[model samples]
Target: MSTTIEVEQATGPDLTHRLRDAIQNAEFAPHQRLIEADLSERFGASRASVRTALLNLAGEGLVERLPNRGARVRAITVGEAIEIVEVRLGLESLVARKAAENLTTKDAAVLRELRGRIESAANEGSLVEYSRVNQELDERIREIGAHATATQLLERLRAQSARHQFRLAFVPGRAATSAPEHVAIIDAILARDADAAEEATRRHLAGIIAMLRAMD
Candidate 1:
């Protein structure tokens, strides 16, 4: 007998977002096939809705739709990973600079809290929690930057970079090193130093890029 995947009824966007998160967190490994019927049942959405979601994810490069094989999580190549980080270096530096200039007291508080959550998850070796908090921190920075266009662009870049980011985080000791980098970023933002914030963001992302390159 085939086992049934438990799925709760969810709206289109919600289901898409959930699947994206699952893919980013390594719940669905790289190149894992995403069958429409299975996902429709798993997300409790109609098959049509599932197809739409898959197409959306495909546009983001999080999933690849094969002509005959259907959709599968995208596997990032070394060259593609390097390109993603290079793009992030420029975009994230801009975000950090703007975040430093625009961060409110409330934003600072929330950022510090997120930094703590990231560090705690890292120390506890919870990759899922670490990835989740890390993405939240990125989004919060974009939010504080308040540039709608940049935020939208960064969101797309992030979706494409998810697989590479997962590989980096899953490496032993990578999370430990990244926790301090995030703290440096938060500290610069709190100090309201735009240059420092931008520089820190560049350094942090550059380090990750170097590590990835070394692995390749």
Candidate 2:
């Protein structure tokens, strides 16, 4: 039985976004076929819209198109995931620096609150909660940075590497180790120190690369 999403309207772009979210969230397992008819019924979108959405996600490296077969979720290997993170290390560092440079009083307050929640989740050893809040903090930083191009690239890279990240989150002591790194990022941003923010971002992503290599 296919699941149905409770969306009022599913335009092509909306369907693509929903599909991307589903893939990233593991609702659709890696390499699971995305049947157009199933997706159309589930999202309340037309078959044509589903095709367009699939094509769009394929372009984002989230979906694969197989000749003589339908589309399926793209399975990113550990090596590819490391490469993606290496790319992210540079882009995210830039974003972090920009975020620090553009930090406002309101942004500082928001980041501090998120930092507290991240620490709490880490202390409680809630992997799911920690991952959720960590993503939120990243998104907030991207917004504050106001770099649309980097943000778009990072979004695609993140989605492609989500599965590997999800696995890493379950590694023993991973969350606790990453918690301080996240705090450092928030601290640098709060201090409006662009250099520190960039360095902290690089450190965080470099840690991810190291973890991925260990898994490999």
Candidate 3:
């Protein structure tokens, strides 16, 4: 579920962030019209603020502005999603390597706990839970890696491709297939094996690409 921003308290940037998250989380359907008046009322912001927020989202490629027709969520094609994941593959592999190199004892403990939760969610056939934990694992890896530039790039890429990912998570047996791959990533980091971590990251993302191709 997406976090709800309290009305009357959200600034322009806060509204933009909240709306971005809503779009990414599928709360707002792809291509759904975003009327300024509707959004202003919904977010309890002024029409001017809503317009500005929409403009910001448009720049991020998450919203499309129509001439005289206002705005709507952008719907990414499967091909586009695959391309985004391809870009992520390189950056994420680098992050995995750096994470393995920088893994401290405390990081290992946190990763282990996240790994356990991922496995449990997969085993229970809980797609929602699995997706949540999988994202947490990625965030933890990024934090451990400490790559600011890559992290910033990934944040946008992930948001852009989030809807496709949400669909993929519902594919039968996907969670089961991805669970071990995620575990391999965590295990390599725990062992401080940078090479293995990078390889594992590559393999995992490669699988996602394959699935995306099959989806196409």
Candidate 4:
């Protein structure tokens, strides 16, 4: 699926959400030019609204505007992907450690449920479910972490490298492997072991690096 999404009706808020969702879902391919007129008609919106949404994504580093080529999904080279994921490793390690300190029993329970759901989806080989779970877990963990700076940076890096994430998830067995890796991170958090949590998170990202390397 092209990660670019055109909604049925593009209200201002609806358009922004649709565009982000489409990008995150890999509805449009990386660097695929998003035709303004086509998108406007596809989402039953005015050309202005589609343009605005694209403009917003462009600001977020998820899309780029070219002089004549129009707006296209931001493409990540292998080096860029590695650099982004490296930054992510540091940010997420902070998240895991802080989340362990801050998460209440109820918060941990919620995370547990989410992980279970992720595992179920992975076992069933549902790529969409896995993708949703992956994002949800990251967001939920950040929420639990309760750190504004970390959350903001993590979201920024995530948006910047979303294309790579999409391709990685689409690989066979990758989604399934990601479930257990998530568990490892969550487990350390629930145990309130900050060093262990950080270490596990590092290992988790390292696993992704390994996966990417295997793909080469």
Question: Of the pair 2 and 3, which is ahead by TM-score?
Answer: 2
Stretches off by above 4 angstroms in model 2 are 1-10
Specify the poorest-scoring 10-residue window by lDDT in model 3.
1-10
Compared with the true structure, what per-residue lDDT tens digits does model 2 show for residues 65-183?
Answer: 99989999988999999999999999999999999999999999999899999999999998899999998999999999999999999999999998899899999999978999999
Instruction: Give lDDT tens digits, candidate 4, residues 1-216.
Output: 222334323376678778877877678888899999988888777787888899888877888999988999887676777778888999999989999999798998988898798888898998888888878988888998898998977876787777777778888878767788888888888888889889989998988777666655
Please give each candidate's TM-score: 0.86, 0.94, 0.90, 0.82
Q: For candidate 1, lDDT tens digit of each residue in 16-116?
A: 88888888667887889999899978877878678878888898888998888899998878778788889988999998999999989999899989988
- C-alpha lDDT of all candidate models, in order: 0.85, 0.92, 0.92, 0.82
User: Which residue runs does candidate 1 get wrong by more than 4 Å?
Assistant: 1-10, 121-128
lDDT of 1 at 104: 96
Residues 1-216, candidate 3: write the lDDT tens digits: 123433423588888888888898899998899998988888888786798899888988999999988899999999999999999999999999999999999999999999999999999998999999998999999999999999988988988999998899999999989999999999999999999999999999999999999999
**What's every prediction's RMSD, in angstroms?**
5.2, 4.3, 4.5, 5.8
Ranking by lDDT: 2, 3, 1, 4
Q: Return the top candidate by TM-score.
A: 2
Lowest summed lDDT across 10 adjacent residues in model 4 is found at: 1-10
Ranking by TM-score: 2, 3, 1, 4
lDDT computed for candidate 3: 0.92
The alpha-carbon deviation from the true structure for residue 144 of candidate 4, after best TM-score superposition, in angstroms, is: 0.8
lDDT (C-alpha) at residue 182 in model 4: 88
On lDDT, the candidate that comes out on top is: 2
Count of residue pairs whose backbone atoms collide, per candidate: 0, 0, 0, 7
